[model samples]
Structure formats: structure tokens, C-alpha cells
Target: MECAGYIDGAFVKGEGARFDVLDPSDESVVAQVTGVSAAQADAAIGAARRAFDSGAWSGLTMKARAAAMTRFGEAMRKRADWLSACAVKEAGCPVSSTVMGAQVHAPLRMTDEIVDLFLRLPEQEANPLPMHERVNPHFAVQSLKRWSPLGVVSAISAYNVPFYTAFWKVVPALMAGDTVILRPNPLTPLSSMIFAEAAVEAGLPPGVMNVIVEPGLAGGLAMTTDPRVDMVSFTGSCAVGASVAAQAAPTLKRLVLELGGKSAQIYLPDAVGRAASAALSVCTSHAGQGCVLGTRVFVPQERKAEVLEGMAALLATVRIGPAGDPATQLGPVISAAQRDRCAHFTRAAVEAGGRVVCGGKRPEGLDQGFYWEPTVLDLPDNSNPAAQEEIFGPVVGVIGYRDLDHAVEMANDSRFGLSGWVHGADRVKALEVGLKIRSGAVNVNGAVMSSYASGGGIKMSGLGRERGIDGLREFQMVTTLTIGG
Candidate 1:
């Protein structure tokens, strides 16, 4: 079926060209998704602005707004099956990974399990600050602080975790009472289209939420640079994110960017084989297309052989095949280009004196799809490009550290600092080492990116937070008022 863009209140045939959405498992054509012209993206931005300005949505009472959000959550839950199918086929997310990851923490399916959490989220701070005491009897002064919605938000979601990332941007901003224009990554946009269905079913104001799937250079540029946009929330690569921030800077629009990560996992001298197993399992999850996947592993130099053996064993057990299969734990990367990326980085690292411990070649039988075997490389130094850069593939590079101090230093010695993981025998020791590293979320012995707290990074990993109170605040503007008699 031909899938068109959802703008304002209905699905429309875009004036721009159309592109084929492919199934990564075998490079088969799943469906056709049409693109919207730059003018169409601007129209979306205009709709959001008009809705916010008209008070059609922003002026709603908190109770009414919350009720709509709850209905949206319920509607999304009803369409969870379609979400699961799209997640596996088009995006190559592991079916089991969507079906309650047995190896990882929490179900990342973005289904009923997660929507309920969004529905039950605590109310935003309506009046965060109290008014000061009266100054005098006749001349009394009152001060009030109010959190108001940002006029309009432009949300650009990433391809890797399109539904999950896009949901975070949409739901919180909607709950904060801001109108949104969501431009889903052209490569993996079906899920967001489904999300728009939920919004419509929940009876959101016609222009309150809009979704567009178009080439990034045109649609994304138009959305980010338009003057009607009050804020831009983006999730993608650092290079693209930098450009988005620069364009929005001139307009002084608020931005929440969740960019790339070369996050590391430090397994101390007392590191258990379980940690190595966890690292291997994660690299295979979503075909290692995750931004927070610990692609770089740091272990005490003495335990390299042990960790390598454990990783090889764990990876051997992973079933890399069609994402449609429920038993399949590892699926193909998103596209042939992504598959090539995995091969190029691994080949480049191997030529630079890195040792390929296991699984670096493309699968011989599975030549139809973008399938490369899980790769584990042993880096001679911490500065190897593969160890320092974000590969966004199923390739794990292992770097050895001298000691605790050395481990911390090496973990923090990257241009990126989105997330980190440290596994040690002593709880206090692990916490200390985890604390020393530069990251938004640090896990002691697991790789869990939870929605319970704020998540984002320092330095180049992108600015602002996305999943907690900070996330809600990102969509709001604060104002103070004083009255005197």
C-alpha cells in the first residue's frame, strides 16, 4: 500500500516525490512512503503555530489536556501490534527485543507497557514557586510563577529508535500543552505515522500534532529554520544535530538534541563473565544501531582474554536472521548502506593493528539482506578511531585499561559522552568509577536506558534532557508576575 504523510488532521498525498520503504531483513520492498515538499513542512510548522496562537489546544484546562493524553496512550496501546511489526521489518529491531527483551531490562517496544507510564506521569508543576509574604497591610504585593507552553515544537526523530525517541518528544511536549510538528526520519518513519493515527483517534485538535516523512535535507531543514517554530527537538547524528542547532540559533529557538554516542563499558579486574555477556548481548540488540550501546568495552588488561572468550561464546549463541522471526535475537542492520558502514569500520580498525577476535565477516548464507556477523575487535590503544567514534553497528571494540584510574580516564577521554557502564565487584567502587565518567546516564552492571529519569549527554553527545521532569520543562516557558494593591 502507498503510505502518505499525515499533516494537520488527515493523510494527504504529498506534492513531492515518493520513496520505497524497505525491509532490512531481506532488502524487500515493504511499502511506498511519499515525501512532503519544503513548502509542506513549512505548512506543518504554520499549523502548529496557528493552533497554539488560536488557543485551540494550549488554552485547554489541565484536566482536559491530561484526558486527551490518556486517550492517546490508550489508542497507541490498541495499535501496538502494527508498531511491533513495523519495528521489526522496516527498522530491523529484534522481535524479541520488542517482545520483552529477555536479555535486557524493560520492554522497549513502545507499546502498552510504556504508554501507560506516559499516561500516569505526574502532573507538571503548574505553579512551581509560591508568592512572597505581603509587604504591608494597605500595600500588599503578590508574586506568582507560571509554567506556560512553548508556542510550537518541531520534533525530528532518528531512524534507529524512531518510535521510542519520537514518542518521548511528542508525548511530553503534548502534555506540556505545546503544539508539535513531527518530521520522522525518512528511512524509518512508519511507526511515527502510526503514532499520528493515535493522535487523531484521541481527538487532538486538528493542528495540534502533525507528522511528515520526507528527505532530511529538505523537510528537516524547512522545519528547523522556519520562524514559526518555537522549539526544535531532534534525535540523530552529531553532524546533523550541529547543523540543526546552528540554524535554530539565529532564531533563538529552544532546542533539545539527542545526538550520537561512543559510550563505553568498563569491566573492572573483578568483572564477571556476566558483564561480558551483557556487552555482547547489547551489541547484537537492534543490530547495534543504538546510540547508547556500549560499543567500546574497557577491561583490566589482564582479563582481555577471558572477556574475549566470553564475548565470542555469547555472540555465537545469538541468532542473527529475519527480524520477523520471534526467536531471532539479532536482525540485519537498517539498510545495505548501514551494513557497509559496519564492514568499513571493522576493516579500517583491523588494518590499524586491531585484532578481530570473532565475527567480522558478512554471513555467507544471508546475502540477500544487510546482514553482517557480530564483530568484536581488540584495540591496541584507546585512540583508535573505531574506539573513539560512533560506528552505529554491531561491532564492539575492546580496549584494555591499566587500572581503576586508567579506566576512568580512558572512558571519559572521548568527544562523545552520552552514557557509560561500569561493572565491578564492590558496589561503592563501581559507583565511584561510574560517577567519575562523563555521561548522562551511568549503569553499574547493566545496559538499561530507562524513562524513569532524565537522559542526554554532556559535550558533543547533544544538549538538554529528554525523559524526566527536565523533558517536560524543555517544552515549557516560565513567567513571573507580581501584583500590588
Candidate 2:
């Protein structure tokens, strides 16, 4: 199939270069995508601007907008199967772990919640202040604060989980009365195309939402640097995120960035016994491509050997194959480039006195696809590159700490603080240790990312929050109105 960029409410073929969307499982051409030129990107941004300024979408009542979003989501749900297949083929996400979870279900669920939350919000609230007799002695004066859309938003998504990430940014921006220009990563543009189709089917205003597919960063850069775009919600690497921030700085664009992480999973003294099983989660969850996965593991010095042994045994048993196999527990990485990157990190770590406990090379008999063995490295200290960097592959480095304080120190020593994990027998102790870790979200025991709260990062992990009430508010600007009669 040939995919075209959706611009100004039309599925327009790009005047720029064309590229093939490869199926990571076998390197087959799943689809050929035609990319938009700079002019096409400008048109997308212009459309969003016109849509926002015209109030074709933003002028609607809150309830009416919510209804529109609900319809959009329903349109998406109807194509769940196709979307899932496209994601598995293009991104190499496992149907068992990712396609069923984040790919198809979770995003739809988040859309419903965002619409509900948007409708529940108060459009305006009364503000109380003490009367200033010197300034204006009007006792009958009334002050009101209102939250409105920030205007045109450019929502850029990452390839790992493209659809959900884009949906996370787009739905809230729309609910807040903003028109949007969505740019999906070049590697995974299928879902984004479907999103555009759904918007049209849902009867969104002509320029309310737009999608642009490009082989390079030109189109995305246009969306970021363009003055018409009021906000940019980005999800990708830290380096690219920094660039996005810099590009958008001239316009002072509102940004919500979800970037990279070298997060830690700490096993308290008592929890060491349960650590190995839960640690295997990194290997199974889409080959640890997730930014929030705890690739750095901190365990008590006394129990480090036992944890590594159990982890190595479990790693030996993981079934590595293509994403389509129901029996396959571990799928290939997104591409050969990603697999090579993983190998490079593993080799570098080994050169730096790190011992490979189980896997450090490509798996056997799966030479065609980009598959890496579920690797576990026993590191001498937290200073190793494997322990410090974001590999974005199925690799974990285990480091031993002297005590709880030592664990906390090692975990917080990194430059990226996106997320963390804490496990212990004592709930109070686990919660306390979790609170001490300098990350945005911490999972106590087996807790996972929930829909009810906000999640983002601190330090180099990037700025702002995503999901929850705080995320919905990110798309809005506040105004205070003072009236006197």
C-alpha cells in the first residue's frame, strides 16, 4: 500500500521524497510512504492556524467539543484490528505485550477519559481578592478566571508507540479548543494516517486536525519552528527533544516534552527474592524500548549474586522470534540500526570491566531480523556506560549497593530521571525509598503507570507532565476578567 500525508483535510501525496516502511520482523516493505515538502508542512500549520482562529473547532461549547472527540475515538476503535496489525508490522511491537496493551486498548481508553475530564472541567471560576481602597474602592467588583485553548498545537510522536503517543497529545489539545498538526515519526506513519482518516469520519472541522508524513525532519521542524503553532508536544530522544526546544524557543512555544531516561529499579534488602521475576519485565516489554523502563537495577550487595543467577536462568528461557508468533515472548528490535546500537553498548560495557551474565550478542538462528538476546550485565559500579546511558534495547545492568541510602544515591546519580521502581516487604519503607528517588513517577511493588495521575520527567529527562488533569491543563491558557458595574 502507498500512504500519503493528510493535509488541509485531504490525503495528498507528498511532493518531497518517498520511503519504504519496513516490517522489522523480516525487513519486508509493508508500505511506501510519500513525504511532504516544506511547503506542504507550512500548509498544514496554516490550516491549523486558520481552524483555530476561525473558531470552527475552538468556538464550540465544551460539551459539543467533547462529543466530537468521543466520536473521533469511536471511529478509531472501529479500526482497532488494522491499527494493531500496522503497529506490529512497522514498529515490531509484540502483539502479546504491546499491540493488545498500549497499541489498541490503552490509547482508546485514554481518549474516553480525556473527553470525560474535559466535560467535567469548569469553564470559568470566580476569583476572590481583598479590596484595594487606594487603587479602586469598588466593593461590587467581580473577578473571574477562565481557562481556554492555547491555539494551534503541533503534536510530534515517537516510533516506539506512535499511535498512543500522538493520541496522548492530540486529544487533550483538541478538547482544550486547539487545532492540531500531527507529525508521526517517519518509521511508523501508518497509525497516524489512520488517525487522520478517523478525524474526517468523525466530522471534525476541515482544518481542525492535520497529519504530515516525511522521510526526514524537515516537515517536523517546520511544525516546531512555525509561528502559527502555539504549542509543541514531543515524545522522542533527549538529544532531539533539546533540539525541538531550541527550535521552538524563538516563538516561545508551549512545550510538553517526554524524553529519554536511564531509570533505576531498586530492590530493597527484603525484596531481593522477588526482584528477578519482576526484572524480567524489561526484556518482555517490547525489548525494553520504553523510555521509562528501569534498565539500571540496584540491589543489596549481599544478595546481588543470587538475583543475577535467577535473572540469567530466566533470560536463557525467553523465546526470541518475530512479533507475529503467539509463542514468541521477545520480538526483534525496531531495526538493524537499533540492534547494532545495543551491541555497541554491550561491547563498550564489557570493555569497561563489566561481566555479561547471560546475553551480550545477537541470538542464534534468527539472522534475518534485528534480534538481540535478552542481555544482563553484572557491572562493577554504576559508572559503566551500560549503567548510565539509555540503550533503548533489551539490556539491563545490575549494580550492587551497600545500603538503602547507597541505593538511593546511585539511582539519583544519573542525568536522566524519568521513572523508577521500588520493591520491598515493608510498604512504608518501600514508599519512603520511592519518594527519595528523584524521578517523576515511581512504581511501588508491582504498580504500573496509571490513568489517574500525571507522568513526566525531571533533569535531562525533559519538561512538563502528560496524562491526568495536569496534562489536560497543559493545552490551556488562563485569563482573568475583572468587571465593575
Candidate 3:
């Protein structure tokens, strides 16, 4: 199959080299995409600039923009299966989670879920006071806040959740009236391209939203530094994010980074078994490609044996199958490159005097794809190499802690603070422990009180929030208006 880049208004093939997209499940050729030239990339930015400057999209009212997004959502729903399949093929993950993350969860939240939430945004905000009506003063002045779009958004999305980021960044951006230049990961561009097709069918205006495929990271240099680009919203590793920050620095583009994480799961001594079980499930899910999957598990030093035993037993029962297998509990890693990365993480843990409790190698008899056995390590300390790093694979590490304070201290010690969780008694103690950890979101027990909350990281994890009302504001800038009556 052929994949084309969407620029200005239409899909076109550029006069550049082509690269193959592989199905990670079997290393088969799924589709091939042409590399977008520097000029072609700039053309996309210029097109978005034209759309923004001409007010073709930004001129619409919030309600009108919402309606257009609803239409696009309908169009996207029609292609949901295509996206799910593409993602499963390229991502090498379970079919069910792919369907949920790409087709169902993200699309709904992007359109229907956020419509009323966005509609409730006040046209004018004030630090309300009675002075406006008091004493009949002539020429009374009140300071009010009016929000405006941030013009052009340059979004460089991570490959892990291409379809979700499509909704995460572009939906809020368009609804907030900003034109966008979308640059998805070169390795997994199929699902997002499907979304661009849906947008075209939904009657999105020319240059309103463009999808550009890059052959390599060098192609990203031009996309991030486009002089006309206003803001850069990136989702990837901290190493790459810092480079993006530097690239966007010259233009002083507004930045919103959703970077990597080494999220932790704190198990209070009372909740050791339950917490360890939850941590194991999270770590093993999706082969742990998820940015916020509680990879570092903090268990009490005393209950380490019980926790490790239970975790190992549970891990043994996990059914490993092909990416599309309905009954498969775990699928292959994204690619051979990713699988090697996971291997390196486990090897590093061993070199640092750690031992693998379960699944340290690839499974036997699964030879076609990039599959690795889910491994849990008994690491030396909180600051060990594997414990502190964001491996982005299905490898969990157990670090022993003394008490609640010790757990919180160990949990908060990571440089990347995307997410963490505490498995303990109801809201009171868990809330206390949750507040102490310096992450964007903290889950208590299994309730996920802040699951739908605004999520972004502190420290090296990221810069801006993605969900909730905070996400709506990320694509906007505030303007203070003062008028005298």
C-alpha cells in the first residue's frame, strides 16, 4: 500500500526517497511512505500559516468549530477499524487495547466528550468585584480576560499512541482556533494518515490541518523550526524533547512537551500484596510501552519475598500471543530496535547487581515477530540504572523501601515524574501519600480518582497538561481587555 503526505489541501507524493513500513508482528511489509522534503515540509507550515492568517479556520466561533470537529469525528469513526489494524500491525500490541486507545477512547474524548466542556468556557473572565455597580462612578473601568488562539501549532507526536495524539493535540488545537502542522513518528504513520483522510472527508479547509511524514529525525529539524510556527507540542523522550526545545528556542515558539516517564507504584506495608499485583498488571500491560505504566515498584523491605512470589506467579500465567490475538495478554514490542532496547535495560540491571524474578528472555517458539518475555527485576536501589531510566518496555523493577516516608521518598526520587500510584486504605492515607509524590497524576488503589484529570509531568517528564480544562487552555493565549463604561 502507498502512504501520502497531506499538505495544503490535498494528498501528494513528493520527489523524495521512499521507506518501508513494517508489520512488527511478522516483520512483513505493510505499507511504504515517501520521505517529505525540506521544501515540502515548509510548504505544510506555509499552508497552515495561510489558513491561520486568512482566518479561514480561526475566524469560526467556538460552537461552529465544535460542529466541524463533530463532523470530522463521524468521518473518523468510519475509518476506526483501519486505524486499529494499522496500529496493531505497526505497534505490535494487543488488538483490544489498540481498539480502545485509538478508535474508541481518544475519538470520543476529542469530539463529544470535550464539546460541552469547551462550550462552558466563558467569553469574558473577571476577578469579580462589586465596584462595577457601586457608587455610580462615571468612567468605571473593569479589566476582563479574552482568550485567543496561539496561531500555528507544530505537533511532533510519539509513535506509541499516534491515533490518540491525533485527538489529543489537533482536536483541542482546532477547537481553540489554531491551524496545525502535524509531524508523526516516521516509524508508525499509518493510523494518523488514516485520520488525515477522515479530516479531508469531513471538509476540513485547506491548510487547516496538514500531516507530514518524515524519513528520519533530520526531517524534524525543519518542521520544528519553521519561523511561522507559533507553538511546538511534542511527545517523546526527554533527550529528543531537549533537542526540540533548543530547536524551537531560536523562534521562541511556545512549548508543550509530553515526554517520557519512569513512573512508580508505592506499596505501603499493609498493602504490599495488592499493590504488587496491581503494579505487575500495569507493568505487563501493552508490553509497557505506555509512558505512565508504573515501571518502578516500591515495596516494603519486609514483604519483598511475598510480593515477588505473587508477582512471579501472576506473570507466569500471562498469555503471550500475536498482536491480533484476542486472548493474548501480551504482544510483541514495537520492533526489533525496541526489543533490543528492552534487552539492554534488563542487561544493565543485571550488571548493576540485580536479579530477574521472572521472564528475562524472549519466549521459545515465537520466532517471526519482536516479542520479549515480560521481566521483573529485583534491583539494588532506587537510583540504580534500570530503576531510574525510562526503558519504554515491559520490564518492571522492584525496589525495597522501609516505610511510608521511605516509599514516598523513593517514588519522588526519579528525574522523570509523569505518574505514580499508591495502593493503600481509603482516601485519607493514600491521599497523603499521593500528595507527597511529585508526579502529574497519582492513582489511589484502583479508583483512579485523577484518571481523567489534567496530565503532564514535572522535572524531565514534560511541560504541559493534556486532558481536562487545562488542555483547552494549552492552545490559547490570554488577552486582557479594559473598557470604561
- Judged by lDDT, which candidate is best? 2
The clash numbers for all candidates, in the given order, read 0, 0, 0
| lDDT tens digits, residue span 1-485, model 2 | 45457777887888888899888888888888678888898999998899899988898998898888889888888988998897789888887774358876888777788888878888798886765721365546678899988899999999898888898888888889999899988888888877788889888988888988888988888888989889999999999999999999999999999999998999988888887875578988888889999899999988899999999988888989888888888898888899999999999999999999998899889878889999999998999999888999999999999999999999999999999999999999999999999998888887555456889999989899998888889999999988776
TM-score of each: 0.92, 0.97, 0.95
Candidate 3 weakest ten by summed lDDT: 444-453
* Highest TM-score scorer: 2
Whichever of 1 and 2 has more lDDT, that candidate is 2
lDDT of 1 by residue, 317-349 (tens): 878789888788778888888888888888888
Q: Across residues 202-275, which tens digit of lDDT does each residue of candidate 3 receive?
A: 78899998988877765578767878899988999999999999999999988899999998888776676585
Error of 3 at 136 (Å): 11
A best-first ranking of the candidates according to their TM-score comes to: 2, 3, 1
Clashing pairs in 2: none
For candidate 2, report its TM-score. 0.97
Which sections of candidate 1 miss by over 4 Å? 1-3, 98-140, 447-449
In candidate 3, stretches whose alpha carbon ends up further than 4 angstroms from where it belongs are 97-99, 102-104, 128-139, 447-452
